[model samples]
Target chain A: MGRTWTLIRRRLLQAIPVILIVSIGIFGLLELAGGDAVDAYLAVTGGGDPAFAERLRQQWGLDAGLWVRFLAYVESLVTLDFGWSVVMSKPVSVAILERLPNTALMMGAAIAFSACLGTLLGGIAALRKGTAADAGITVGALVLNAMPSFWIGLIAIVVFAVKLAWFPLGGIASFDRPDLAIGRVLDVAWHLVLPVTVLGLAYMALYVRLMRSAMIETAASDWVRAARARGLPRLRIVRRHMARPALLPVVTMLGLQAGNLLGGSVVVETVFAIPGLGSLAYDAVSQRDLPLIAGILLVGTLMVIVVNLLVDITYARLDPRVTDDRVRAGGA
Target chain B: MLKVRDLAIRFAGRSASEAGTLAVDGIDLDLDRAQVLALIGESGSGKSATMLALAGLLPKSAKTTGSVLLDDRSILHLDEREKSTVRGRRIGMIFQDPGGSLNPVLTVGDQIDEVVRTHRRLDRRAARAETVSLLSRVGIGDPAARARAYPHQLSGGLKQRVAIAAALAAQPTVILADEPTTALDATVQAQILDLLVNLVQVEHVALLLVTHDLAVAAAVADRIAVMYAGKIVERRGPEQLVTDPGHPYSRALGQAALPFVAAGDGRHAALPELPGRMAEAGGTACAFAPRCPLAIDRCRAQVPPVVPFGDGEAACFRAGETAQ
Candidate 1:
């Protein structure tokens, strides 16, 4: 337990510099894009007086030097207060927290659905290599992977939402009731169907291919032959010997893909019109809400870091041969 | 005791025009308990295939025709489950490359303990204790510490010892060692062979030792079967096979063994070497006739049946003449 903690701590520390650089670079790009809280405030508030905008800019420290503004941003981050969003007129942290749960809910569902379907299909395909089932799955995965996520989402909405009238095309929940109960949750889920399916299919296709390749490679290894020669039952060989090592590479790939998924969710969320972080970030970009955009970028960066860290810990647990020092060192 | 009769294996050819190639022809072998029988042959001589068939570990694609009897039960007819029950529980196998045979992720102790846990209903603690004891039995030092070490952490010789320990964990009645010492250094090979012989002797287990080296077979085998082109051409006591070979292939192997000695000594003339490679025998009269220097008109026209010599068998029409 102590060793694992040490490993996690070491990994967390190493990620700090990477996250710092990423955040700074994102903040710098947002600044260079010629946007400010004063402009967003004037636009959202329907053109306030010039003096009011100037006072607001000075109050938010937006009228300071770049380094001073960066230092203030870091200080606010350390204080767990990401300043106020000029467009939403709410604390950036509150806005992020409010929207984060929705994104989390969608991502969680997609991951769960994809992992189960992908692993099962991958295992079957690998076990029946060169068979019809394998060929069908390989072709299906190629098609799914090659298709654009937004296009898939739009097509699903057209078929299931507009044409079939089975689901709502936009928004997270039915606008009539906004309570956080089981019925409302189900309604939200109903609306998330197209987006989640699009994201899940895109992600699961790659996982299946990865798992199939890894399993095929592992099956050809000598240890698998040794396991067979030991006279173990076939299922036991697949479950105990072949599956674990094969899944190791899959786990690593899944972790990296999860990070990519968070980034790619922007397109899917916008297409589905779901009020998740991806849609929120897209709205901020269109309105040029600097504070909100920076906050979203920070949140996305943090999500990547946290997910990767969790994956590293999971990897260490699954395969003890992967030492903490190596994971902390990071990347080939 | 174990016996294999009329064993044959045919592999499908890549092209439709070519007939299925016979990897092992009608070969027969018998080994008594507490004795080692060495299957000696070159790479393509069907020695390993015959052993795999006898062990019931042959791939599903290959066609096998034979009766492999372990004591009284015919193993060839058994289903996969029954074959597995007979394999590690009653018949243990040691593969050629010890490094490749052992799992890299597992500790040596866990690997051996797995064998015990598979065949026996021992608890984890009891299985682990037995694993350490088996490790010590295989002559590994610091058995407790060694049990926790993975295969990559150990040397090649140590890994082989771990393999032997795992094989012995089941207390099998028959152990098939396929070139067990081929990958080890000279001194380690000697030690591993000594450990194998001592363990087999003490446990009264039948050993089917397979090797291409005549000298290695001579070192540990009680009876030697020289295989040529998927058939056992000759079977005799180790001393008789080495000193008075009957079949032409056995004679060639024996002469090849002589070159291992220092080359410059004038006191003894160099041994005669066989000419040409062993050609792939098709559906022909005799497999070795193409490579035999003394092949006559009759030798090419007819296959030789197993003829009894002193206390062994030789499949040659002119065994006595060949010996001369």
Candidate 2:
């Protein structure tokens, strides 16, 4: 546990500079871009007057030089005060925070769905290696892995929503029952089903392949052979001896896949009308919402860094060899 | 007591064009309590294959035909469930690579205690106590403290001792050690071998030590069986087998062994080498005929049988003819 804390402290210290650099990079790129949010605001107000544009630029502090604006952006981030959204007229953090829970719920369900089902199927395939069952799973997982997530999402909406009428085609919930608490929850869950399945299936195939290969390799290892020779029950050998080590690579992939899943959610959210970070970022980019986009990028970068740190710590926990390496390196 | 009769094994090939390869062909062995039989052979000579057959640890592709009798009951015909019940309870197995044999994530105590709990009706606390005692029995100093360490934390020799401790936890009637010290240092190998010999004497357990080194086999084995191309070509008491090898291959192996020198004379000794590769199994009537120095016309056409000697048997036509 002490080692875990030390690792986390070191990782956090390392990540601080990376996060700052990412923030600076995003801020500078957005600042130097061709489009201006003040120009868009003036266009929305149906006026191209020079006085209104100047007033808007000064109000948002866009008149400042690059270094000054970049410092202000870092300062606001440190204070947890994301600047106002020119498009939404609310704090950038508030706009983002409102949509975060929806995206979290969707991605969480997707990851959980994929991980559990993939591991189970992958284990079965490993146990039945070189059999018809193994071939079936291998081919099926490969086929699913090759399909794009948005295409699957669109097809799922058509089949389950348009044809079967079992689920809604779009939006977070049914607007007709907005005030019904239980109904709204059910409606939200129903809307999430297709999107979750699409995202989960895309990742599920990769997980299945990773887990299956890991299991096969681990099962063929001498330790597993020794476990079998110990006369341990077959299930015990599979679970206690083989599963933990096999799942190590899967856990590592999960951390890497988190960032990718966020990117994937944008496509799925656009098709399904879910107002999550993906859709928010898409809108912010199109409408030139610099503060909002910066806020989203900064938060997303931090999340990925933290998740990666957690994965490393989990690796140390799962394989003591990793911990030993750290100890040999003077508790790095 | 354990007896294996005409034990033959063939591993099924991947494709139809390739026939199943015989790995252990028609071998017989017998052992009583409080004796160690070392099955000595080079790589792919069926020594380890024979041991795996006795333990029923071969894969599904391996077709093992013959009988393994443990105290009069036929263990070969048992189902997987019954076989597993008999495995750790009646026969314990020690592997060559001790570091890889133990689970990396588990503590040494947990691993050994699992074997105890599997064979005996004991609570967690009782199992831990038994594991610690077993570790001490294997001569690990500070057994309690060492029990908490993982496989990675211990040295290779210490890991082998932990493996030995786990094997001993079941109180098996027979212990099958497959090159148990092959991965350890020379000094550590000697210590582990001594520990095994002492355990066999103290507990009255039959031990089957499979090794490729003739020296290792001669050191602790009361009886040694030399295997060539999936068959046991000779079986004799260790002293006689080392000094007066019966089969031509056994004589060749003897000449090939590093000669023991009393003092500085060891500096310039040249070891003799066997000249040819081992014949493929089941392809020749006598697998060793192609490599044997005394291969007569009949040696290539006929399979040799184990003929009786003073107290053992040697599977060679020229074995009795040579009076040396």
* Segments of candidate 2 deviating more than 4 angstroms: A42-55, A173-190, A327-332, B16-18, B261-267, B282-286, B320-324
Q: Each prediction's DockQ?
A: 0.49, 0.69
| Candidate 2 TM-score, true structure as reference | 0.93
In angstroms, the error of model 2 at A89 is 0.5
Q: Which candidate is the best by DockQ?
A: 2
Best model per TM-score:
2
Give the least accurate 10-residue stretch of model 2 chain A, judged by summed lDDT: A323-332
Query: Fraction of the real A/B interface contacts present in each candidate?
Result: 0.35, 0.57
Candidate 1 chain A least-lDDT 10 residues: A323-332
Assess every candidate by TM-score.
0.88, 0.93
Comparing to the true complex, what docking class would candidate 1 get? acceptable
The number of the candidate with the highest lDDT is 2
| B84-186 per-residue lDDT for model 1 (tens digits) | 8887788888888998887766677888888898888799999999999989988999999999987877999999999888877888888899899999999
